[model samples]
Target: MSLLAARDLAVARGGLRAVEGVSFTLDAGQALILRGPNGIGKTTLLRTLAGLQAPVAGEVAGDDIAYAGHADGLKPALTVAENLHFWSAIFGGPPIDAALSAMNLTELARRPAHALSAGQKRRLGLARLIVTGRKVWLLDEPTVSLDAASVALFADMLRGHLGQGGAALIATHIELGLDAQVLDLTPYRATIRPPTSRPAGFNEAFA
Candidate 1:
């Protein structure tokens, strides 16, 4: 069964259309990797799929998805375990043990999020998906600060996620060894928008 899908989708960043004529269907246990150069709308498309932003055109249909963006979404003042616990409560998933173990974070579970390294923070962000119990994951730059060993660990966890009937759509520059179908957004790039169409707030003076 199709877990999530986009049909002729168009996405905008600010007033400019970044991606257009984009379409795909992802099923349970499947994965899709989005590849494109900088400023090509990979993040925009992922945000649209995650429902953080509305699509400029076309349709996206899905539910119960977890979105992990560039930011770790952790509170600097909160401990690693506390962060996971907070999100787990919000999503009503299992305990934090599995997530901590999966990310190899058991040793540092008590450390404050601000005290962790960049890679450790990223691991915690990814762990949130496991705690959420969401079947679909939308990740943007998931491997940003991961080292070779951590990347390998992340790949193993991702494979495990797919093995358990979950799906993922990730926008990343490096390969995570998930053998995902590549969806290059280069061909779908939209033309730059005119200045007049840019979104302006009510506080701004009208032309």
Candidate 2:
């Protein structure tokens, strides 16, 4: 069955339509990759999917989603263990230790989030999902600053999540190796100025 589905969705910001006539269905163990020019509304569509942005039209229906953005929202003062505990408690999920270990965070359990490098922090943020056990994951730029190894680890986690009947909606320029259908929103544009020629330049929509 589909875990998340958006029907005839339309979102407008400041009287400008960012996404119009958008729709799709993401089933358990399936993923949907959203690709488009920056102002075309990748993040905006994510917000709407997570119920953070109200759409001007259309319907988004599904269970609760695990939402992660650019920042990862890690607390600097909290240790890796504490951060997972706090997030798990607030979000309600399964055991966190296994998740942390899977992300290779076993040694840094007691380390403060601020002390970890950028990649480590992102891992910690992702570990929160292992604890919450949410079936629907909405990840934005999940591979932002990670090294090759960490990116591999993240991909492993995502694969595991999907194997266990979970679904994901990711907005990323980097490849996740998951067989995802890229929903590009550029075709709906009435007037996309200066037409970008670069490859993988989703932000050109805002130009």
Candidate 3:
């Protein structure tokens, strides 16, 4: 069975439809790479799928999804291990030891999140996905600030996830050397429309 499916989806940015007619399915042990130029609503589409925002039209059907965006979503005061433990508890996931080792964070397990370098912090953020124990992952630019070696490590971790029958949809510019299908958003670009009146206290700037 498919782990996630999106049909005739339309996602908006700044209160304007950015991409529409987007449809796809992700099956277990599969990975789908979203490809598009900057400002093409890739993040918006991912956010809609992740349930951070509502889609203008269409539907995203599935569950057990975990999303990781540009931010690491880590608590600056928490240690690497503590951060994973926190997420594990929230998601009812397995032990943090495996996630720590997978992201090569075992050595820095006790180090505070604020103490790690940019790459290390990114790795730790990615490590949180493993502890979520969710079947589907929606990642937006997950490789940001990661070094070549770290990127390769992430690819290995993604392979492991697929091996376990998990699925992923990633929006990334760099190549991750994975056997995954690529979906370009150019064909789905929505025609720009006139700005519409906003509701009270609505902020299009952040939308």
Candidate 4:
């Protein structure tokens, strides 16, 4: 079976349909990049895929996919290391020491998340991707607020995930360096359509 597949997906926000009849299939070890302008349905799509947001229609098929969204999804009161430990506990996964070191966050591990800069929070949020031990990932703007070095580290970790046969659905304007296949939602939309109409049955229409 495909590692990730969104069949007849439909999502909306405040009466706005962000994604309608959107569908895609991803094989194991592959990654797909979801690109569109801000406020478009990138985050919504990622959230739906992650099971964080209920889809107005359609469903996502995959294993236990880990998700990291636009929100840092961190508790500022906790230390970076503590944040990682919290996620690991939730997922019943192992420690993320290596991932932290890869991002050069070892030094700041003990600092409260609130004390970290925006970039640091983003890096801390991504650490869960490494420790989740899941096969699929749903990332929304995974590199936001990151410095160049941190961005590079994010890219490197993506390479590692792909190399390990993981699949990802990344919704971000930033490039992730995975040489990911672009999944543009633009063509699926049209000025004439209301964005609510179900896409004519999937038959390679968007492939």
lDDT of candidate 2 over 73-108, digit per residue (tens): 788998999999888888777767888888999999
**Prediction 4 TM-score vs. true:** 0.86
lDDT (10s digit) by residue, model 3, range 1-207: 799999999998877789999999999999999999999999999999999998888899998999999998899899999999999999999999999999999999999999999999999999999999999999999999999999999999999999999999999999999999999999999975444754557565433
Give one digit per residue, the lDDT tens place, for model 4 in 35-115.
Answer: 887767787788778787677777878867888877867898999898888888888887878768877789999999999
- Among all windows of 10 consecutive residues in model 1, the one with the lowest summed lDDT is 198-207
| Root mean square deviation (Cα) for candidate 3 | 3.3
The positional error of residue 34 in candidate 2, measured at the CA in angstroms, is 1.1
Off by over 4 Å in 2: 190-207
Q: Report residue 17 deviation for candidate 1 (angstroms).
A: 0.7
Encode model 1's per-residue lDDT on 10-82: one tens digit a residue: 9888766788999999999999999999999999899999998889889999997999998888999999999
State each model's C-alpha RMSD to the native: 3.5, 6.9, 3.3, 5.5
lDDT of each candidate versus the true structure = 0.91, 0.82, 0.93, 0.80
Winning model by TM-score: 3
* Residue 158, model 1: Cα distance from true site in angstroms: 0.4
Q: Which scores better on TM-score, 2 or 3?
A: 3
Worst 10 residues of 4 by lDDT: 198-207
In terms of TM-score, which candidate is stronger, 3 or 4? 3
Clashing pairs in 3: none
Pairs that collide in candidate 2 are 37-202, 38-202, 38-203, 93-132
